[model samples]
Target chain A: MSHIHIDIRKKTYPARDGSGEHLAIRDLHFELAAGEFVCLVGPSGCGKTTLLNLIAGLDRHFEGSIRADEGAATLRIAYMFQNPRLLPWRTVRENIQLALPKGEGREWVDHLLEVMGLTASQNQYPQRLSLGMSRRVALVRAFAIRPSLLLMDEPLVSVDAPTARRIRQLLVRVWQERPHSVLFVTHDLREAIALADRLIFLSAPPTALLHEVTVDIPRGEREDETAVEAFRRRLIGEHQQIRDLL
Target chain B: MRSLLYHPISSFLLFLAFWQGLAVILASPALPAPQAVFQVLYQEIRSGNLPFHLGVTLARLAVSFVLAMSLGTAIGIFLGRHEKLDRFFDHWLVIFLNVPALVTVILCYVWFGLGEIAAIAAVVVNKLPNVVVILREGARTLDRDLLEMAEAYRFGRLKTLLHVIWPQLFPFLIGAARTGIALIWKIILLVELLGRSNGMGYQLHLFFQMFDVAGILAYTIAFVAVIQSIEALVLKPLDVRAKRWRR
Candidate 1:
């Protein structure tokens, strides 16, 4: 089972005002085996989100090329945004069903909604949901797709601390159930620590890859102490070094 | 429940009292008392022509409103789906929104030669832009994550729209429809007055020409009552039902 190899080399977007080019990704390169979980952390305005968009083929205007070696576009890629971004009018279940492949969508929608603890609120709309609940709905919506690649962009930014922990657990469980490559982007160092198998630290503006640290902390362990201490000393050092650059 | 009904009426009665009090102080007949207006309204009802005129006006308003709503919604959905198209037609919406309804009605009359189509067209032209703007804004704010999820799952375009986009846009569309109906009715009446021979606006003009203050007040009261009934019986219930998803 070969994995997706996204060779992103020298991507840039000309600044909107045309004064200068906003170099979003400069000479970026990365490869993930089929089931590896990757987390990308960066400073504010470091353009990790933009890079995610480019990789997803949502944005085609860039200086460089992205060659996807393994999965076809039909292999499917689920993306979760900073905000849950649930459709306000659709019931949470309907929102998930809307993401499923026609006839096969309903059962998965039901199952995933249950998995996300949204079965009770299945009939409720996005506006009626709390922040954590909304993000969970977003999670179920993304996870239900059975994507070859799961791309997450700071999806839990607004949830409470305790809720965030629970969500992190759910994410890991889903990852275990269907071992897909996940490109998780976050600003939270603790979050990048808790979830990622491979952590990539992105540099400040005119974003470029800085450090690639492989966290060997065993999964299914206590997320707080187990994940943190395993790579804490080295990860913290790299985190602070990148922090000073911004 | 009783207080809710009484509050607005009492407020209106108080306003009328102030106007009547000023009328008494100035000793003028130009501004009639509320009772006088009510009396005039009663007299118009007794005259037996009120119902026929009211019926005609209501019919005109219905046709105009429906035309404006469906067309505006269709155009809005298209504009919302296509950003390039939205930009191209955005200036047209600005022009329509700013143009006075009366001036637009006049132009319709000039172009269409005083037929019922002119009246209907005038109301539609005035009402369409408002609905379009509301729907376009709704379309722009649609959640992209949900859409990306839909794409990833490989839902057909029909399923995505039916289950995803339509459900999301329904509340916005319904609210726009409700408010647009309220606006379209008044504009339609104006169009009826300037161009069409029958309808509330035309009847109001007729009463004015004949110095029949009671008749004018009767029609005004009738239209106001109809609007309130529509709000209470139709739009309010629809809104409650639609917003249940949000709840």
Candidate 2:
């Protein structure tokens, strides 16, 4: 099945403080296919989040259109944010339950709990979990409902190095089997290269898509670090070039 | 031993001893010592009128406090969910917050014709706005990402409130309740003084009319003791419960 075409010909947000205006994104035309992992790479202040918000329908001011061809108008969309954003009041399992359609069975929640390695901590709330564990819970919360499109906004940035790699691996496995499209946003170029099939690089502030690069890597848990190293170097190279310009 | 234990009783005993020593050095029998006060308290208790009147006063105080807390929390939650509603009520809230409890109680008596309803109304009005302001600020200061996450997963408004909004609001509610509970007891006494019969404040007024300082002290002690019990038993549990969401 084909994923949606986001022909966001232009997107603009009016400046709240009357500082002229804010151009979050402009003329962004992209088509994502089913089972494709697309990453948006940008500087820290770039509008990757705004573009993700547009796709999520959390905001609707974009000039163009995004049409999902595969699902009905009510199909669920999952999102993982930079902060994990789990409710501190809710237990780890309950946060996943929030994603499910009402009256859905507990079995699906149980499965995700097991897969996310949160079974032991299922009764604990978000504040009790480490940053990496909370991020795992956040990932499971997004994937629990089997969304039509999963949107991730720098989901692993808060975790330590070893845990970030593990989470990156977990995300890839879920992406490989997601049965939907993923629009991943990150400022980390290496993260984009590691998980994305195609990477869209967004420049600073009033962000514009500078370039899109395609990555070809097979799936598996082979612990070879060379490709990851090479991808990191390439993204770092791009990062330096973008940094100089911005 | 647990978090709720109060340490001021021993300090209070020491303070009383120091007062007694000062009175002894000054050789003044006019200032009753702590021992004399305790003797008076024991004689009043043995006569059984103390417990009866104390229970009546405590019951009135409890009714007033419970009414204030439940109604205050409801008003607080309502103000929290509606921004324009909060703005419209802002001046009204400030008006009530700044009004002296004695003046508010007298006004309630005049307006509502000096009844139990007037007394409860006074307590409720006195306590409500602080809770509203506290929870309004709590709701306003809510983490933006948690809200976005709720929408992202498509949680319904009811679920969002119960799971997301309420937990964040609870700590503030507890804080408001702590302060409100304190304010509540004092306001209830004033309400009882201005309108009601058979309460600690009414007895205090009676003692004042007779110029009976010991009777006045006894009634004040009874009311303070009741408020202290509620604090140690009730509000402390709520405080712990609210903070439980953090870890």
Candidate 3:
């Protein structure tokens, strides 16, 4: 069954100058299965972040409907942006705590910090942390609230390769421990294949769904670099459209 | 070498030495020696006049500062967020900012009749525009990304304000406060001198008429000392605490 349904009929940006309205997304529709990991893969500037924003309910100007099967009002959603977007003045621990609903305990926060190997730097400000550490804190913040759905927008895009690998591993481990539905947006097809149970590809702006591919490999074998690359090669070789787009 | 020379104590002592030297050269009552001024300052304090007037002036400063800060911050945030309202009142703010403090003081006393309310109102009017401008700039530059983060995380109005909005506005608020305190106190003194019957300014006025330069110097020194202590004991500590998160 679908955990969330997104039917974006149209979304547009009004002209700032005297130009004209620019269509961003049109005739896009998709559903995320319960506890499924879905990666939205697209070319650069394909309104992927805009789509995430629309689903997260940050922008209400679009003509569309995004509903969670659990009931939209009661649904808890956590979003991890492209940047850390942490409150620089707050400590890592406090930044995570800001995500918790009222009267919730700090034990979950402590547990996540320990799991992410950020317990030692919990009290330190974001400025003191490396980019990798800040990303982990952002992840911890997203998970602290234990949202029913998590939306991530290229969260590991700019990190160094080693750090990205570590973060990706930690992310998979955390998601495995507490299986929440996630709609992860990334431009990297290889990264998508490595992490996603299902991959949703998109066309360029006025972006729409181009194709969807289910990763056939089990979660255990998908982590192996050789296996992930081989699967990516096979998938691209078979699909002429995805090969062209990627 | 520069650090030692510019140490606050050493710099202060150098200032005193220069004053003493100038006093000896001029030998005028207007520029009394530091020791002579301190003697007068002691007598004034012992007589209880200095403390009483200082307290009265400080009380006025406190009232006006609080009023201006709260009112200005609210209005600043409002204008900064609403481009239309800001544009409408932009000229008004400029006019108020450019109006002389002396004119405001005279107008308030003439309209409100030489009362405490008039004195404080004058000070508030003189300082309010500055606070509003600083905080408006702060409100304008608020981070849209962080705001979106707050919204996505379900940070309702109050939490968004306390966590996301307030921290971003803090440096601006601090800037407003520091400049506000300095500007308000000076305006308060002018208001007191022009209208009120009691305050450091009134005493200074009396000293001016009698050519009691020593008394003037003494009162000035005592007031300066109090302001310095406040900066050291209150504002500096607050600043340090706020900046603890930064490297």
Candidate DockQ scores, in order: 0.37, 0.74, 0.88
**Evaluated on chain B only, what are the TM-scores of all the candidate structures, in order?**
0.87, 0.85, 0.97
TM-score of each: 0.78, 0.84, 0.97
Candidate 3 docking band:
high
Q: Which of the two, 1 or 2, has more lDDT?
A: 1
By DockQ, highest first, what's the ranking? Answer: 3, 2, 1
> Judged by lDDT against the true structure, how good is candidate 1?
0.79
Error of 2 at A80 (Å): 0.6
Q: Each candidate's interface RMSD, rounded to one decimal?
A: 2.9, 1.1, 0.6
Residues B81-173, candidate 1: write the lDDT tens digits. 899999998898899899999999999999988988887888889988988888888888877776765654556688778866876787888
lDDT of 1 by residue, A1-60 (tens): 346766566677778999887667777778777788899988878988888887777777
Docking class of 2: medium
Candidate 2 residue-wise lDDT, A1-246, digit = tens: 557788777777778998877777777788888778888887787878888888888898778888877554755688888888887777887778877867684876687677778899999978888999989998888888877788998888867889999988877776665566889988776667777788777767667767777876554422456786676666557666554533
Choose 2 or 3, whichever is better by TM-score. 3
Number of the predicted model whose TM-score against the real structure is largest: 3
